[model samples]
Target: MKILAIASAGGHWVQLLRLKPAFEGHELIFVSTKTSFKETVKGHKFYSIPDASRWNKLKLIYSLICVFKIVFRSKPNIIITTGAAPGLMGIIAGKVIGAKTIWIDSIANVENLSMSGQIATSIADKSYTQWPDLSNSKVTFNGNVLS
Candidate 1:
C-alpha cells in the first residue's frame, strides 16, 4: 500500500511523525514545508512544498499548485495529515484523485478542531480529534498520534 503522509512544520509535523509506526510495511511518502525534515525522514520518500498560511493568499496559491503536481504524480492509495495549510492542500488534492483521506486534528487544538480539520470533515473519509471531548457526529476519537 502506498501512503502519503503530509503536514506543516512544528507541532503538526511532530504529530504526523508519531504516526509513522502505523504505516510500517507500507510504501510511505512524506510531504512537509521544511527541507530540514529531509534528514529526519531519511528512509522514506520526501517532498518539500512551499509553506503557506491562510493569511498569505499568494503563497497559498503557489502551494496548491505544488501539491497538485505532487499528488498527481504520487497517486497514493491513502493520504493522511496533521495539519494547518499545507496538509489541507494535500487532502484536497488526494480527494480529487480518489485516494482515501484521513485528517488527524493536531493535539494542540484541544478546544476545537483546527480550521483545516473542519474543512477536511467535508472531504476526508475519516476525521479524528485528539481530544475525545471534541469528537462528535462529524468527527471520531479513535486514539491519537501521540499515543
Candidate 2:
C-alpha cells in the first residue's frame, strides 16, 4: 500500500511520525510545512507547502496550487493528517482521487477539534481522537501518539 502522511509543522508533524512504525511494509510519502522536517521524517518522499492561516488568502491559494501538483504527481493510496489547515485540503483532494483518509485530531485540541480537524472530519473516512471519552463515535479512540 502507498501511504501519504500529511501535517503542518511542529506538533502535527510529531503526531504523524508516530504512525511510522505501522507503515513500514508499505511505501510512504510525507507532506508538511517545514523544510527542516526533511531531516526528521526519514525514508519517505517529502513535500512542503506555504503555511497559511485564516487570513492569508494569497498564501492559501499558493498552498492549494502546490497541493494539486503534489497530489497529482504522487497519487497515494491513503492519506493521514495531523492538521492545521492545509491538511484539510489534502483530505478532500485525496478523497477525490480515491484515497482513504484518516484524520488524527491534535492532542492540543483538548475540548474540540482544531479548525483544520473540524473541516477534515467532513471528508475523512476515519477520524481519531487521542482523548478517549472526548471522541464522538464518528471519531475513533486511538490513544496517544506519543505513547
Candidate 3:
C-alpha cells in the first residue's frame, strides 16, 4: 500500500515518524514544512509545502494547491496526519481522490484537540486520541505517540 504521511514540523512530524515502523512493507511519502523540517526527516520520499498558522490565509491557499499536487501525483492508498493546518488540507485532498484518511490528535492536545484535529474529526475515516480519557466518541484511545 502507498501511505502518505502528513503533518507540521516539530512534534507533529516527530510523532508521525514513529508510525514508520508500522509501514515497513509499504512505500511511504512524507509532507511537511519545507523550511523548518528539512533536516528533521532524512532518507525518505519528502515534499515540502508551505506551513500556515490560523491567520495565514495566503499560506493556506498555497499549501492547499501543493496538497492537491501531491495528492494527485501520489494517489496514496491512505492519508495519515498529525497536524494543525496541513492535515486538514491533506484530508480534503485525500478524500477528493478517494483515499482513506486517519487523523491522530496531537499529544500536545491533552485535554482538547487542536483546530485542525477538530476539523478532521468531522472528516477523517478514523480519529485517534492520545489522551485516553478525553471522552470524544470520534476518537479512539491510541495512547501517546511517544510511548
Q: Clashes in each model (backbone N, CA, C under 3 Å)?
A: 0, 0, 0
| 1-147 per-residue lDDT for model 2 (tens digits) | 988888888888888888799998998998889888888876679888888877988888889778767887899999888887778878988988999998999888888777777777778999888888768868888688876
- Best candidate per TM-score, number? 1
Write one digit per residue (lDDT tens) for candidate 3, span 1-147: 999999887899899988888888888889998655656656668899988876888878988999899999999999999886888899989999999999998898987887888888899999988897864778888677888
Residue pairs that clash (backbone atoms under 3 angstroms), model 1:
none
List candidate 2 segments past 4 Å from native.
Answer: none
If scored against the real structure, what TM-score would every candidate get? 0.97, 0.94, 0.93
Candidate topping lDDT: 1
Question: In angstroms, what RMSD does candidate 1 have relative to the true structure?
Answer: 0.8
Give Cα distance to truth, residue 31, candidate 1, Å.
Answer: 0.2
Relative to the true structure, how large is the alpha-carbon lDDT of every model?
A: 0.93, 0.84, 0.87
Query: Considering TM-score, where higher is better, how would the candidates rank from best to worst?
Result: 1, 2, 3
RMSD of each: 0.8, 1.2, 1.5
- Alpha-carbon shift of residue 50 in model 3 (angstroms): 1.0
Error of 3 at 43 (Å): 4.1
Cα lDDT tens digits, model 1, 3-114, are 9999999999999999999899999999999989999889999999999997889999999999989999999999999998888898999989999999999999989899
